[model samples]
Target: MTATLTGVDVAPPAAPAKRRRPVPGWLAVVPLLVFTAIAFGVPALAMLNGAFTVKDQATGASSYTTGNLTASLQGAYLTALTGSVKLSAVSAALGTLLGLPLAQAVVTSRSRAVREAVLTASGVLANFGGVPLAFAFVATLGNAGVLTVHLHLTDHGWDLYSFWGLVIVYLYFLIPLMVLTIAPALEGLRTQWREAAQNNGATGVQYWRHVALPVLAPSLLGGLVLLFGSAFAAYATAAAMVGSAVPLVTLQIADALSGNVLVGQENVALALSLDMVLVAGLVMAVYLPLQRRSARWLA
Candidate 1:
């Protein structure tokens, strides 16, 4: 009855508006660009400049020369480099060998308590470094250490300040790193694959060689590379244990910079840069293949 007087009411449809804010490409990279410039680029350039320049003792005049780089390529620096490389390789290889089994054991264990204990121990050992670990090893394996006292019982001797001793100490750190790295890789493996392999009558060794290895290789290789780098760059443990009696590249560089020789300051900086570049190159060489293989596997 009221329709005679009521006006028809209607609403217009809302328009579909475009997004007002778009992400800025340059803004996304700003933090990285800033970090590179401040943290790496500037310091790298400074070191490069210092490496080639000879400063006058009195006037401090700088003259560019290849003498420092040339000297570094020879003499103690070269020997130290070789030693560092050898030690790193040995430690990494040994660590991987030891860790793979330990990781497998931990991951495949039926006991949750054992797995928890292993993981906890690894986590603790991973962060253990410097004088404390060194002293602990020294007190256990040094000439006057607890183990040395028992060594005479077996006609064996212990010297915790030697190269092999350093390797053993390095293994303590490297094993934990290997476990931390490889255990996750092992755990990440799908149980279905193992079950399927077993269903096909594949032995443990066969499954490992064919199925598990291919899957785990990337992580294993990555862990080795990391261990090598850590061992190569190590100074504190070596210094505390053997001091300059065994001249590691890092320790030598530190000595050059801080020792009584004032002229070696710039050379030390140069040597450090060289060491950095060499280690970086070695890491990249190891990393690229693993990365490619990993991508292929994932793909």
Candidate 2:
């Protein structure tokens, strides 16, 4: 009884689990917000002002006016805008069509060597750009190029400087982009699904149309939009290949920046601003529908 009276040893109550101070969410976002304000918001506002404001050359006076904006909508500016949309669409479609098969081939192959080779080749071609790629294309297809010289194909009248020629050049960039984008989706597809589809007597086309495409549609569409944007924004390849002979929107913008002969500098600024607005609208239009569809599909 006297021994039981000794002080009993006991562990101290565990310090209330140290409450992690909630990370200030705003801190994480401040950098992005600052970047947006500086990089996009201010510049966009300035462009809007420049698009409307008339700057007098002699008096150095600037006044807000809609005349520049209106002027940008007419004549060659309008034509170039339309051409850009058409070109982007055509190139995107072509890239997606070509990429689907290549993606399937790469993802389905059992051989790691083949996959590595294909991916390495794709990466190399994708990075190969600007003047070197242009010159390579020229050396292969130009009137005085190897193909023309060796095969005597000049009689067929193949020209790589035309609108279609730009499209062809664009594909070199587009195909690899599509492959890089779509390959991930293909790899994500479960092997059992294909086997199940085969066991159920579904033809390969039916399997793709019904089983695979629906699953892959979101990725495909996203990649297509990316390809479209790439082609739309591309400058050097088109410039080097076609130059001023073709009136691309990028070329027009470049001319504006350089004070080229065709469009006045102010008008050029207005034209570029107009193009930015249009492209922003287009991106939103495409992105919204795609996002909604992807959400629904994923849900």
Candidate 3:
């Protein structure tokens, strides 16, 4: 029609393009959501449900009750909980304080091989836990162990099965863990901040106090909480190393579940597990906000 009517300069109008409907982006994460539901949600719900359930020994009847939870707050159980918290706090503090320098040293090192070796070692050691780790410490520091035989540590009243001993053992893994966690935050620290501070006549200590430490505080705190959780939930290492002698909440929970001390105590174990879950949840509740705040600056 345009060619036939070319002399008159007539043209037909173009057709409009069709618009496509928007796809829901969240659908892409459906598999992850499903996997999380199966992996974490279901188990957590089951554990929570069991924590509040009670079984009557006389009639073998089950009922909803808070007795187990209430019982968890009294006597030896409470002490165990307190002990776990104390261990976690001390270990996390030590790890954060000590690991920061190591991480900084690694970052500042000119040797790429040294940095790689340090990071690799940190990665391996951070994950070094459970039975083997316990055995390693025991073989190194036990009464008749190599170091003990060489130095006579037991003669000086240094027992590797005690609380302080447990802390020392925990530091093996904890320090490396903190190193891995805080190194990225340390790297995130831009050099310009330090240079600018120095140009403004600020000293090294002042720069670190006013700029570096303040910026790193949230990440360090977050790593501390993570370390605390790691230590709090630890079972195999402490159990294999010291057994019931340590009185950790994890051991208490294990004992309750095993029913060695008292029959039908699994419910109490569930209650203890619930208590741990709550504590961890409370910690994350505080940590997430700080992590978010840190991201704002880092980003």
Candidate 4:
């Protein structure tokens, strides 16, 4: 038998400390679900309905038909769609090519100030597109503008209101966005990997070609996809700069909604929106998989 201490009294074993029940993960997402339903789901349903339903001009009778979607795929609409796709491809390609090196430099820099300055600028410029950006470009690169006059770009056949100019404007933002997106991936590359390559008698080019490139492939592709989507859906800048000269899907959609070209084409605008959604969905599909693959390596 154990003897009790002279001046001490024991406290009762605290009624087994209560174990709090864990919160359900789904409960945490309820607010997000509600917001999504209200924001995206409702608008999507409305768009889908509008895309399919048509009203008779004289009778004001509404009926469902595939004509809107069919029309969206034909003639001028088709041309606009193709043109937007080509422009997006060109801008995204150029942005990726230019951004990769800049981002790589940022990641490899020894100076913190240089890296911070670049990243800060990129953040601002990536979100710097739209009307103001359009105006800025016009002021500098327009036919009678300062740079055009000074550099004699006019004599060189430069046209800021053309498709190529639109691509140039897109690159202005896209390259910065690429820099932002890919920098993290570049940073994820470990020194050990390079050391391992060097230990195997690999040159800098060989190390990148065999090892680093393989690791970064997913990230590069993902950045390209992001750039493509940004270029694909861009509206205000192109609208302000090129106007109807570009024949973009966005411009066509705007025209359809505003009835500038033709009245009673709102449903066609919705159909164009549906097409945009599909293209955006395809981009997401590619991006999500690449993101997951990169996470495995980078994380």
lDDT of 3 by residue, 1-299 (tens): 46564476556988988889899999999999999999999989988888889988999989989999998989999999999999999999999999999999998889999999999999999999999999998899987789999998888999999999999999999999999998888888999999999999999999999999999999989999989999999999999999988888999998999888898989889999999999999989978987898888788
> Which stretches of model 4 miss by more than 4 angstroms?
1-23
What lDDT would each prediction earn against the true structure? 0.81, 0.80, 0.92, 0.96
**Candidate 3 Cα lDDT to native:** 0.92
Residue-by-residue lDDT tens digits, candidate 4, 1-299: 33457866666555787799999989989999999999999999999999999999999999999999999999899999999999999999999999999999998999999999999999999999999999999999998889999999999999999989999999999999999999999999999999999999999999999999899999999999999999999999999999999899999999999999999999999999999999999999999999999999999
* Cα displacement (Å) at residue 219, model 4: 0.5
Q: Which ten residues in a row have the lowest lDDT in candidate 1?
A: 1-10
Q: Which 10-residue span in candidate 4 carries the lowest summed lDDT?
A: 1-10
Q: Whole-model lDDT for model 1 versus the true structure?
A: 0.81
For residues 41-103, could you state the per-residue lDDT of candidate 1 as single tens digits?
A: 998887887778777779967788887777666777778777888989999999999999999
Model 2 CA deviation exceeding 4 Å by range: 1-23, 288-299
- Report how far residue 18 has shifted in candidate 3, in Å: 7.2
lDDT of 3 at 232: 92
Clashing pairs for predicted structure model 4, backbone only:
none
Name model 3 segments beyond 4 Å from true: 1-22
lDDT winner, 3 or 4: 4
Would you estimate the TM-scores of all the predictions? 0.84, 0.84, 0.92, 0.92
